[model samples]
Target: MSVRIDITGLTAERIHFAPSPLAEMGAALHALAEPAHHPGVQGWTTSVSACLDPCLADRMCEADFLWRTTFSDVFTPSAGLPGLHTLPGATLGEELDLLDKLSDEQFVDAALEFTCQSEYARRDVARLDDPRARERALELAAARGSHQVRFTQRLLEDPPAIRAWFRELMQDCDEAFFSDVWGRVRHQLVADARLKTDLLRRKGVADALSAVSGSVSLDDSGRSVVVDKISVGHTETGSGSLVLIPTSLGRPHLWVLHRKDWQPLITYPISSPGLTAPTSVEQLTLRMSALAHPVRMRLCRHLARGSYTTGELADAHGMTAPEISRHLSVLKKAGLITTRRHGRYAQHQLDLSVVSRLGGDFIEGVLR
Candidate 1:
């Protein structure tokens, strides 16, 4: 119910096999599936671009593109992953050309193929309630050394209560986020384009959006499934193209639905095995948190040099005794710095050993 999916025994390639002649389009699906090919997966979408603040989508696009590009560069394909080399159709170049020149009809075919496969593929990504699935998928995608696996395995073993402490924004996000109605709103827009429908009269999207025109079919369980027949309009005129934009919304896509019928001209698949870098998430969450403030980071820096007592630290930081105490209290809560009372003035220190590990991870995140 919480968007959790098992993904226990899943492999990334299984997604392309079903719902399409992926073996024939095998070249196509595999080309599309990888992180390298489209580093823009989470940033391109047609839905919210139509409604949300225009600048909002663009700004979001810049930010997500930055992260995804950075993340994609480091995502080494799993060595044993099935589709790494089983490319069929045209070379990736050909497929990319096809992607750019893809018609409304073609887009429908691919999307239906993708969705059908995703129906099964999602079973793996979504069914996972365990965050370890995320951790493992990340390890599988970003496998570097045994230490990563061992470390992640150990962290995964920790209970969820502690895990949940790490939040995305360090603050609460409301429903306007891509999770609730807006998510569906964008989804409907893309689905409309993908399904290429004007009315849910045929499909079940209700009186939602409409589609362009053209027809597309994919091999569904060895059978051809007519995904759509719709015509689509391009937002970027004279260019004959659709642009995909990914969003921060937890939902998996940002897309461009052909206005003619509603076929998705462009879709950015934001969800993936390594998409949830648990360690990075943890580090980012902790670091981004304004626990003690800039002054606190300075304090932490000083403490890392060596520990000091409350009075000495307060005088050094040029803060009053109570003010410094408050800062130390916040740092303690953040698990960054700790203090122990000695005589009248409590000794405050960087909590070196623990902070060192945190610093190591912080460096790792930056490296990643």
Candidate 2:
């Protein structure tokens, strides 16, 4: 469930963080499909919902075929961003023009490859023939639902329509949702890139990447970087560089895409108030402030035992519920804890991975 990237020959200069409108569009679509995964982007989601054509919004929210993992690659091709090292300077019209140029054969081939990667699709499409694959594709499609099955069948029968549908979705999102969202977050995205650059200048590539998330870390041998929550694993022995893209859109999780013909890319969430670790000095200072208090330290230790409600923590600490609530809020803001509502009561639990890393990082910073 992790990707072990072998960065043996990669230099700090080779690692780049750039913004991508195509990547942002893909992230926005993902957020729309699984709103629960991105609680921090509720405001953007609401704005997107309001801007989208009612039918399109409903399809984005309620349709399974539209949100399928295969469709992400299908919709957002690498051609949109011809240069991997910088924010794609291409206009939306240019990007869409590139998408429109894709041949029907390319669409069909990519779709088949994507479908084969799916667990359900692989089982159904036992043979490689188009007729058999098409027949079985319907069975695979039916797994998502009957409505989607027909749509999938049509796409399989007429590959050109797949391109048309993808273009339509992108056009809708580019005009309706992505333009506004990107305008609002572009500054933060640039700031995040600057912070990473500063970390590279002050610390090193290893420390800069480690600071990104608890889920990303250097191995004991120091030859590999392991990214958690990814099912696929591969070693890059080629001479290609690694691209690191920081985006406000891809919050709450990191996305990795590897291709032999292109630089391996990692799109991670930039630091934000309610999302993940703070990468810059100001943000880090605020996070470190949470641990500066003794009462909060005691509360963190207590929560480490197990999840507890505000009243339960108050009773254990001999404090009022409001006092415990304030302490919990600080811990939550520091990314050291998470709270979930269970009926009328809320349960709080320590994020042990982050807490342990913070302790180790503090010690290392002091010793150095």
Candidate 3:
């Protein structure tokens, strides 16, 4: 549930915050595919999805590579824009140039490795040797109708065709969606990068990282940083500098990339006031609806004390677990509470800041 980054002997200079235009574009495509996960970009998601070719959009949505692992080196910090300060100033032409220069081998290798990194692929071919496992991985990938399956297979069979398809996909996204979306979000990305840079300058690393998100924190050992993610946890030990990228496109979650060769990169949501502000009128209606019930209010009050499992709350209230789970879901979607899994059960806790903000916003609106 968390990725622990071991930076035991690293200095402050080792941590760098860089924004990427292409990376944001990749994130935007991700949001487009999974719009429900990114409430902040719902409007853009709809707009961009409408712009994309139906077949292409479907393929993008079906791409397990994009959704599953950050193991894809093609989206790494060094892959797109060159320098740390280059992203804010990068143009679409630059992204295209970088994409054009990407070797066919890098794309094929990343795609295949992505398949191998998946839980299903790992499980399917666990006992098999390398060659057989890779073949089985491809079979499983193709059976799932994965977006990159055809491209990956073609790379081994007809390399030129795979390269052409990859280029075409990149060009299609860049021309149809990325260019305009990047233009719209570029200033915000730049502002976020500058803000983080200023924080690093004034407050040092720990305070700066803490400011980004509550889920990001320095570990108890003070020798590493822990990122609260919902994926398989791993410990990476190396002497590489850490790159912290603030992305406007990837919200509500942190994307960590830790490969053998590349610098450890953590792309987290940008802490912009407006970006993290309370929900819109429609969203407020949903939150208000979720809070209107007596049982849910009591649940919130109970969680205010500390985190509680659904079973515990159900037992305390003499209600069924299913009923409690439904209530918890409502509260969670309303941003009133957060749930983290521990073993087999999920612990739900009230988000005090969100509750306070909701109250303040309600009071101000009523007064107005």
lDDT (Cα, tens digit) per residue for candidate 2, span 292-324 = 899998888888988899999999999999998
The predicted structure with the larger TM-score, 1 or 3, is 3
Per-model TM-score on C-alpha atoms: 0.28, 0.63, 0.65
Give the candidate order by descending lDDT: 3, 2, 1
TM-score of 3: 0.65
- For each of the candidates, give the backbone clash count: 43, 0, 0
Candidates in descending TM-score order: 3, 2, 1
Q: Which ten residues in a row have the lowest lDDT in candidate 2?
A: 119-128
Question: Model 1 — which ten-residue stretch has the worst lDDT?
Answer: 72-81
TM-score of 1: 0.28
Judge candidate 3 against the unseen true structure and give its global Cα lDDT, from 0 to 1. 0.65
Instruction: Record all residue pairs in model 2 with backbone atoms less than 3 Å apart, i.e. clashing.
Output: none
Query: On residues 1-368, what C-alpha lDDT tens digit does candidate 3 reach at each position?
Result: 55677878777766777777666766776676667666767987887667678887765655536544332445553532333222322664455455555454444444565654454112233212356655765776685575556655555565456555655676677777787777777788778767877888898778877877766778777787877554444444355567777778776657676544445677777765664542444455567899899999999889999999988999999999999999999998888898899999889999988887786555322311
Q: What digit string (tens of lDDT, one per residue) describes model 1 on residues 172-255? A: 111223334333344533443333322333442212111221112222332212222111222211212112222222222222
Once model 2 is optimally superposed onto the true structure by TM-score, how far is the C-alpha of residue 366 displaced, in angstroms? 33
Indicate the residue-level lDDT of 256 in model 2: 58
